[model samples]
Target: DEYLERESFETSYFSTVAAAQEALDKHTAASAARDNQSVTGSSAFSEHWDILIIHMVTSKLDSHTMRDWETERNHIKSIPTLEEFNSFLKNRADLLETMEEAQSQKHTRRHSDISHNRPKTFVLIPTTRINCEALNIPSHIKLADPTFSVPAEVHMLLGADLFWAVLSNNRINLGKNKPTLVETTLGWIVSGSIQVPYSKHNKMQSYNTVHCHFLNNIELEEKLDKFFEFESVSTTQQSRTKGESECEQIFTQTTTRHPDGNFIVTIPLKESPECLGDSSQQALIQFKSLERKFNRNSEFKQKYTDFLEEYQTLGHMSENTNPQDDKTSYIMPHHGILREDKLTTKLRTVFNASSITSSGKSFNDIQYIGPTVQDDLLSILIRFRQHKYVVSSDIEKMYRQIYVKEEQRSLQQIYWRSDPSEPIKLYKLNRVAYGTASAPYLATRCLMQLGQECTDKNVGETILHDFYVDDYISGNDDEQTLIQTCQNSPTEFMGEKC
Candidate 1:
């Protein structure tokens, strides 16, 4: 029994010794490969790695943990590899891992504490974005709110014609229903319904509806038309005389044009005319006056001769005779001269225009009154005094200088005859007539456009501000510069002199 036990113990000891020797040899080979100059096709070892292994037999009463061969057979006091004395530490990986876990737990707790203490925030939106598709809104609509609750007072304003409005989904729809134009006097209060979805606390009813007048649409339009009638003449002799007289007094003449974006002037006439209302009587008066003045009134004759020189019409009459209207005889509301006391008054002639012909169409209907170029008279006078030396001149027949387009001339027809025996002639005024509402607008608009086109900065600026009607007034600090502006202005703008 003792021999058997002994044999078994020997076998166990030898096997353990052999296994430890093999492990030692493998570790040595790896180290040798690292140190070698040409080991070829291997990168499995690092020269800087610090590696230590304990070669032990697990059987028997376990030996003391040791990393070196030179340690006591049962225990190791220190490592043997380094030149300096080395100490041994056990469970190194476990200590490092435990410390890392504690640090991670501490960071997580700190993050949770900060999150719990912080205040909450909210975002607000603008009124413009209530209809996202309609309005071109940018991203990042979320913004910091200045208030925790709604303001005590919020102001909402709507522009003209927008007083009657509809709001849906925080969006505003202005002038969905316009005000009723009842007559020339009472304006823009009408009845209408606005259909739309309602948003929270809308100012208007959930379904917006309004009402102003009780009259039917036709009656409303008719009554309104009477109050807003245009300048026109009649065919019957008596009506023509009465209409022309009324028309002569109706037009209100002023130099400044309002930028109404439309061309219509309201004239209210009240003074007595030099000639009677009757066209036949006026014609007789004109013919007699012209016959007597032709030999004696050289100035009158000169004007008449100059008018003829303009060749405003072919001596032959227009042949159009749709109604009682003959090509030779044109229908005009009235005839008269403007600003007779002014120096340029010699150039101003009355070329009365019929707003609506017997055919029921009106010339002023389609025309547009351009924006105002005339500044406030007080402002212009102030600007005119800006310099020491003031320069002034009158445009010669300003409206006449700008010719009426050929197609438009036919719209401006007139009546002319030398004597009772002569045929009453139909004549087309070749130029824009001063007596019409659009004349001032056309003349000033052209002049203003010309001024804008001027290249010289000073001259352009002067022309833009200096004029009122046919009158031109400007001033400059320098005499030569003023003279230069005066000289260049007329030449550059193709200005015609009286």
Candidate 2:
């Protein structure tokens, strides 16, 4: 509400105007009552004089004061009044009507100007997946068995009609239940209900339902005809044997290549050859198939390993920095130390010490500088001589956990500047956060407070842990002690088995 008051001038002006109008009415009424039953010409003059005085005083006042007067005048005018008061209201209404007429004219003119300035027409181009598919040639394709040569031609003609229907209305009905070929194929592929054939020869080219539909589509054939003028036809000969019939060679001319470079090829074979007789032959074929599958798997694994090695090597080389700067450097405090008298009183009492750590002493105090300082400190401390077997733990989403103090919330607000047309907005911090320079110091202070509590409780005698934001590394002499310390800490490590 406070922010709303700041942004809207009309709201403030309306409130002030209302109050001023109320005050004027009260003054008018009091003056009229004082001059009651008096027929002197001075009575009318006195009333007008009082009204004029009120208006003058209100006009000279600040916006809030003027609004208060307006509010008072409006309140008093609501009551049954003298003839002269009614006449005054009628005149004021006429003035308001004139102002409103002028405002309405201005608004209409502005609206007309805006409407004329806007774009006359806009074309919305298709970009989404569904819209793109609607405009695509592949979506109109249909597939059939490659060996069915006679039916394939018939299918092509039917597919052309279906494609036209889809293009006209963006949908079609094939029968009582079946819809367009594109819809059926999309349903199968998207739902993962169709079994797609995996090809080891070409990973990029696999026989899926989508590919099957695309290949048989009439629109795709038309596109190929336009671009490539494909031609030529060829056939392969295959021999087949049947029961009680001597093994006879059949010269089957099965493949046909279209004029647009698109081909319709066929291979003569039983749908499931293993379903035939001869158990020993089927076993031998199965073993050979397994061997081929193993070979393909091994080849894929080797290629993947080579790719990983190259990727890691390139990543490391890119990140390689000068050794000297990588080493941690100690930083001195920027501000002067607390005075000896203040420190003796505050620190000595707080720490319950016989003597406070003296100021300006290099051994007693130090600070870490730079963005990577915390990471460096954690690494060095984990490897320190006094402790070993460090187990690192992290508070899940720690920045979102800590609450901001109510009084200091505004101090944490960030003003975000967007486009020029939109005003800058303030984002109030609802929780502790990163990215701000002061957040790290604030988080560290919170951790210190928690540490002080733990020390007071005297829990986990041999364990030593230090926290930096969400991350914590607890060190002990052995693995068991470190594990125990982690169990005692109030945190869930990544919500997994800790």
Cα lDDT tens digits, model 1, 316-419, are 22433342442223345433333447764454445444344444433443334333445445555655655679888877656656555444455555555434
RMSD of 2: 41.9
Q: Output the worst ten-in-a-row residue range by lDDT, candidate 1.
A: 112-121
Say which candidate scores most in TM-score.
1
| Alpha-carbon deviation at 377 in model 2, angstroms | 1.9
In angstroms, the error of model 2 at 32 is 90
Q: What's the number of clashes in each of the models?
A: 14, 33
Q: How many backbone clashes does candidate 1 have?
A: 14
| Residues 1-498 of candidate 2: C-alpha lDDT, one tens digit per residue | 533332244334544554554555455445544444343346555545545444443354455334433444554534323434433433332222222112231123232210001111132211111212222224444433222111122222223224334332233333332223333322211211122224576333221222122245667557645543333111111111241011011101433333432222221222222222222232234334434443556643344334324423532112122223322211111111123466222111011011112222221112111121132342334344346576666665454445543332332232222222465333334444344333454444334434433433434112223555556654767889777767866443212211
TM-score of 2: 0.21
